[model samples]
Target chain A: MKKNRLGEFQELVLMTVIVLQDDAYGVEIQRDLEERLKKRLSVGAIQTALKRMVEKGFLTSEFGEATQKRGGKRKRIYSATPYAHQVLREMRDLRAQLWDAMPRLGTSQA
Target chain B: MKKNRLGEFQELVLMTVIVLQDDAYGVEIQRDLEERLKKRLSVGAIQTALKRMVEKGFLTSEFGEATQKRGGKRKRIYSATPYAHQVLREMRDLRAQLWDAMPRLGTSQA
Candidate 1:
């Protein structure tokens, strides 16, 4: 897991970015996360996690067109890379294998 | 995830203990793990993981009968607890949810 371990927060943020698709900028991501998590989160925290994932190659970011809502500041839109899904799928299957191999809490297999 | 995060090695060791059933001890566990991982690992490493699991209440250990093969030293046999399965199941389901929610690469879901 260490070779490509995605921190839990990073995993969540990456998934949110995928779900958000074209709308995955910092403020929007924070809003979506807060809504889903049923709690408030600092924009700074979400941005920090997003930045780390971009550095880790699990994500890529580009500046979007400046918007009037944000006073002419372009948002840094984020997207999950194929490499992100590749590592995620690997971990998912690894976990599935472990689950399937288990003797399931005392059945005939045990 | 942090509430009950199991280290990857610890998860493997716990599963191996359950799979080994009554035969789980330091030597047997190390052998099984080495076979599965196809790499040499120290007995001390296995024991350290086992002891930590015991402390965490994920495992229980008892001394078996002394054997002349090991110069009358008793073998400490280990068994996974229900709590171990509980946490493993939670992590498994969590991963499954993430994998399912993911839009498959280049799919319509994306």
Candidate 2:
């Protein structure tokens, strides 16, 4: 399997899409990221990541129902592809393995 | 705290260094990454990541005792700095939060 290369911000955006499930649009993902990470993020940055991931096959986006709340604009909802989940699992396993291999040190507490 | 920006390959190298602990030199880290990741990684790539991370303050290196096995040349062992651990923690927490928020779906199993 080819490795999935994701930058830190891209990974965060991808995870946010998974977390949001059916409600994952650009604005909503940005909001969720800000809330969870406690850091301000530009909508453009999120959009760029979303676009890049979509191109990379880590995420798929489709137009959702046109909502009156946003003047009948149909939001583009993003969802994690199976490839995304696979990469995430790989990342989690790699990190866990490294963490497990760490020697117990008195000075370092994380 | 400033964000520790690591690319996917860089993150893998960084984690591999942490996994190797006291034995984390370029050759050893490359070997461990190959074993765990089941993929051949270039020595140059690993060395570049180690150098970059050391410059970024995510890792520290120290010269270890020379051995006759490899012509008695001192090896520079790399270790994860507290900053690296902190970033790893942040990444873990973020991923966990996103994973927790995900709705269970029959189609997706990770």
Candidate 3:
């Protein structure tokens, strides 16, 4: 496997996980995605995507103590591995490079 | 299905499709991601990811005329759906909003 490999959704999830820090979990991730992205994401879709990322070694999850927030159900908190960060860095750099190469085509630059 | 939905890699791939315009295809998409992203992306991984995106209604592909590039093997060309573009726009807006919310902490601007 490549040292820095990630699916796009996985990258976004990882970024959200980093933003959420210790509070990162299924519900929070879902909430952040919806609120921040102005889009709706199904719990099943998020869970399935999270599971795939975990299997790909881009993410790690552990159970958290039951909380009243979920009727005492343990929330599986997720965090990005160092490898995940590395992949995200590369992706960002690549995107930034392309953006840099583009000519300013809008009045926003003026 | 959501009106706009996309994974991260799917977003990147779709962006490349838009950038590549009429020339977008498997090998070119893989090349752009690898070269622009400075990341190694296996052909199989790219192909598989593209297949999934196509199934998810994020993309559409068509068989292209074989070129000297890869003998007579048809290259499956890909293009973003209007829905894909909408999803990308939403994702970009969301990310930009987050970036905008952050206080400037770097000296690069000064």
Candidate 4:
């Protein structure tokens, strides 16, 4: 099978989904990313990216039970698929390979 | 300048544009990417991505002189800017650092 490539934002978003665990949803994912990356993100953009990821099979989403607090609007929770996890591992490994080839990264600047 | 993040496809396209150098036009870029990646890409998608990259300042485009080969349609040539080059370097360095942190990557797996 061919490997799917993740965009920079896609990878970060995927990692965030993992970090958020079962609580991953549009609003929560956006909030978590904002907090961690210290970057401003629009809800619509996050939703669009999330939808795209889902279509690409990197993520799976399901509607959570509606809560009275939000007037019965269910949240669409997201999680990384097994494929996503494998892709992340591969990316990490590829990055690892490139890093190991460089000896002066963490050393003194000379 | 704020560090801009690259998407997987965006990075691949940027790298292809860089590889194509002065000959980097839409058709050549599309063809080059298809040849190197062994994937089919639409002209519209490539053009859209290229336009987006230009908007993000990761790429710059200029109209090349219309050649008789293309029936007088000037090709839009793309090139990575200094900012793009810096981002690529940073990404490479980041990958390198991550790789070096993995001690067992290149070692015998037991």
Q: Score candidate 4 by TM-score against the native.
A: 0.56
- Stretch of 10 with least lDDT, candidate 2 chain B: B101-110
Q: Could you give candidate 2's per-residue lDDT for residues B1-110 as a string of tens digits?
A: 75557777788788778777778899989998899888888989999999999989999989999887857688999999898888877777878888788766665775
CA error at residue A17 for candidate 2, angstroms: 0.7
Q: What TM value does chain A in model 4 reach?
A: 0.86
Strongest candidate by DockQ: 2
Candidate 3 colliding pairs:
A8-B8, A8-B9, A9-B8
iRMS of each prediction in angstroms?
Answer: 3.4, 1.6, 3.5, 7.0
Instruction: List, residue by residue over B55-109, the lDDT tens digit for candidate 3.
Output: 8888898988887764668878887777776766666666556545433335464
How far out, in Å, is residue A42 in model 2? Answer: 1.3
lDDT of 3 at A13: 73
Question: Could you give the candidate ranking by lDDT, starting with the highest?
Answer: 2, 1, 4, 3
What residue runs in model 2 are displaced by over 4 Å at the alpha carbon?
A: A1-3, A70-72, A106-110, B1-3, B70-72, B106-110
Give the poorly placed runs of model 3, Cα more than 4 Å off: A2-5, A68-70, A107-110, B1-34, B37-90, B96-110
TM-score-superior candidate, 2 or 3: 2
- Writing each residue's lDDT as its tens digit, candidate 4 over B8-102 gives 77776777787677788999989977865567999987888888889889999998888878476888999988887778677666545433433
Cα lDDT for residue B13, model 2?
A: 86
Candidate 4 Cα errors over 4 Å, as ranges: A1-8, A22-28, A43-48, A51-56, A61-77, A87-110, B1-8, B61-76, B87-110
Q: For each candidate, C-alpha RMSD in Å?
A: 4.4, 3.3, 5.8, 7.6
lDDT of 4 by residue, A19-45 (tens): 677788989889977875567899997
Error of 2 at B23 (Å): 0.8
Better of 1 and 4 by lDDT: 1
